[model samples]
Target chain A: MDATTVTTWMREIETSVTQERDRLVQLDAAIGDGDHGTNMTRGFAAVVQALSQDQEAPPGRLLILAGRTLVSSVGGASGPLWGSALRSGGRVLGDQATFDGPQLVEVLAAALASVKDLGAASVGDKTMVDALEPAVAALGRTVGEGASLADALEAAAAAAEAGMRSTIPLQARKGRASYLGERSIGHQDPGATSTALMIRALQRAAAASS
Target chain B: MAIQTKPRKFLNDPADVVKESLAGLAAAHGDLLRYDRAAQIIVCKDAPRAGKVALVSGGGSGHEPLHGGFVGRGMLDAACPGEVFTSPVPDQMLAATKAVDGGAGVVHIVKNYTGDVLNFKMAAEDAADDGIRVASVVIDDDVAVQDSLYTAGRRGVGATVLAEKIAGAAAEKGASLDKVADTVKRVNERARSFGVALSSCVPPASGKPIFELPEGEIELGIGIHGEPGRRRAALGSASEVVDVMVEAVISDLKARAGSQVLAFVNGMGGTPQLELYLLYGEVDRKLRAAGVVPVRNLVGSYITSLEMAGASLTVLQLDDELTELWDAPVHTPALRWGV
Candidate 1:
């Protein structure tokens, strides 16, 4: 993957976040505060601004900038979690001028670990982790099997979507849904949906790059 | 009809009231608060100390001292204030995370509102992309909307304070982000809250009440946004109101035969403490009769519904850990202890 590929992914993430904004907020309304759509829109809009202005920055640096912008802009729990994921992923990428499938997997793994450390949400918490963990694992497995970058990302995106759907039956163990006790089950986890969007953005970006 | 003069005088424009109020609040509480005017963020002036995981939270305007006033040594690391009753746009939340993130990572304590949850989720994604480890705990202790179809879900109410106090102490003791998150989840599980609004709030800018109610009637399960409640009922005595509210909270707690609990009697914005304590008196008695021991108690306005006249009751089953944290020193302007 090259800088252009990363840029394409960033653009995809922005678009996906925008497209899914209302849906995510609607899900959140089921078990959370009702500002997910507005919040995501504001954060992604900022990311787009940052990416568009600093075209010469390396992919990693651009991601780091985006992460910092998010941390400084978005409010609420997700801000720090997503910001850390990007920052951690960017750190892992370092100054590498380009990253192949294996390198992407490593960065993703590191990003996932960083998110886990920050959110403390495990696999079954009915949180973003539900989607993110599965997607990252799928990406790693596909890359390990020597699939092309686009194919690995596609697999990850599919896994993430499945994971997001799986959250519908989960009794939330993290975030606001946990407050509902057993009632939290039966509704889709908003965070998981957003996580799926993030992974799908990666897949779309990779396909575009190819 | 005669036009009435506005009573508020501290603002430049009606639109600027929330921001100006926050500015004044920060100045008065400067020792404990560091306000980011541009970002509309507030942080505990001292943060990121080794061995302490930061606790952060936030929401819209009107709930002053809520996400903001709670910022102190034992409460919150940061708070992002949003527009009136609207969730803080994500930009503020993102800024708060960066300010409070101390290498050990930060835990965002959120209310269970759709807007608040979504914004926080997006911010988490952004944070993930960055390197700051972030965790979130969504508080949904309110039990009023157990069966509502018109609303998003159950609203977060009184239990927010209990969650913040408990989680803040846990983080202060150097609990890992996971431990803090779990502790928050545990409290949410054991706690339940219910509230009734006696009146509706008038937005600072609009200067008109969001909804109108008959003088002799009260909205039974009124949410903070002046949303309709579970049902309307005649305005009753303090004891009578407390009975209904406490009953709702107790039933929702699902406490076993002999569980001990911490009770918080919170005042909505326009309610005075005198009235709150009167209601608390009834609540304390009813709780005793219910066979649940009131292990600890808090009575005051920790959370508000703009300027609405009402109160909410929160009951949490307490264990050793929670009790200890509840007893920890907290010095926020709204609630002060230990220090």
Candidate 2:
């Protein structure tokens, strides 16, 4: 994908996150800290502003800027987690003027590893990793099966949605959800829900490009 | 219950109270701390040289001595202070990362609250964009909430202090950022906490209680935000209160025989140390009987709820590394040891 296309995708994700901001926060209020929507919204808004101002910036730089914006604007645990994911992903992409499906996969793998390294949270922790791990795995699987970028991302988004749904019955082992112990079960993870939104945003971006 | 009125006169505008207080705090404790008033960054005066992984944390005001008082050698590299009860915006945290981040990346330590977590994450992203490697650890130790349908999950409480202390030492010992993050995650896994609120905290600006509670009633498992607890019951003696709080914490920890644990008896605010000590005494006795060895102990107001009268307990299973870090010397305004 080219820089312009990636930028369009980010803007679409920002819009989606804003549209569902309150819903995400509502979900979080049920079983996590009640600021997921606000945090994600603010971070993406910052990214939009940065990208608008620096349209000439390369794809890697744009993603890096977006990551920084999230880190600075968001204030919950997810802020850092998502911020690290984006920043690590951007770093892996380097200054590439454009990228392909395999390139995107490589970047995503690095980003996921960075988040895992930083949060030290595994998939079953019932945080965003629940959604992220599945999405990444789906993307890898699609590519291994020789699917196009659009197909892989579509599959990833679906897996992420499934992962988000799976969090409903999980007793969180990470972040504020863990504090609830048994109480944390039976509610969808707000982070997972947001992760699905991010993946869906990517799908939309890829479709628009196609 | 009716609200009580009191004279209010301390410094400049109420909006600037926290900033002014931090200024005075830094001035008084300059020997032990280095304060960046503009950035609201507080670090150990004699911080270790570059190359050591830096541990930084932050949150809103009123939880004084928390993100601030915890700054010192073998503790936090920097502590960013936000507005009262509000998460520090991105600018403050970004400034903190730049100030303390040596060539070695910085680790941002955050609490479990949505605002705090989100803001810190933004800051880490900002740092990385600036070509600084940054990692973050979120602490969610409260066991008061059901973690279910009614609220936004569990709040970060007592275990935060212990996590910072232990994790800070680990970073100081030259652990990589990834390693420190892992250690922090391990501690979070083993730690559980519960709290009680006897009174509500009044924000500095409004000077009004966030919520109301009856004179003879206590809110069980109340969050730091004056959120309703699981249940409210008639107030009981200090020992009885300890029994209820300890029971919740122990059960949450899934306490079993021979578990080595770290116990912290933390005051919410107005609760005096005398009462805290008594509560700790009861807690210690019960823990001993349960066949759990209390490895490291901290008693005082490490975390608070404005001027609320209450306390919380955090119990974390300990290993050799955590115990050693816990035992390490830390010099901060609120907590001092191994001096």
- lDDT minimum window of 10 residues, candidate 2 chain B: B1-10
In model 1, state the lDDT of residue A129: 89
Best by lDDT: 2
Give the fraction of native contacts in model 2: 0.28
What TM-score does chain A of model 2 get?
0.97
Task: Considering the two chains of model 2, state its CAPRI-style docking category.
Answer: incorrect
Q: List candidate 1 segments past 4 Å from native.
A: A1-210, B1-10, B147-151
TM-score (2 decimals) of chain A in model 1: 0.96
Query: TM-scores across all candidates?
Result: 0.64, 0.64
What is the Å distance of residue A15 in model 1 from its true position?
Answer: 24
Tens-place lDDT per residue, model 2, B158-226, is: 777888888888887889889887878888888989889888766665555655789999988866654
Error of 2 at A156 (Å): 34
* Tens-digit lDDT track of model 1 for B43-141: 888875665788878887777558788888887888888766666756777788888888888888888775578778877877888888888888877
A147-199: candidate 1 lDDT, tens digit per residue: 87777888999999999999989877666566455656798988888889888
lDDT of each: 0.78, 0.79
Candidate 1 displacement at residue B179 in angstroms: 1.0
| Model 2: lDDT of residue B218 | 94
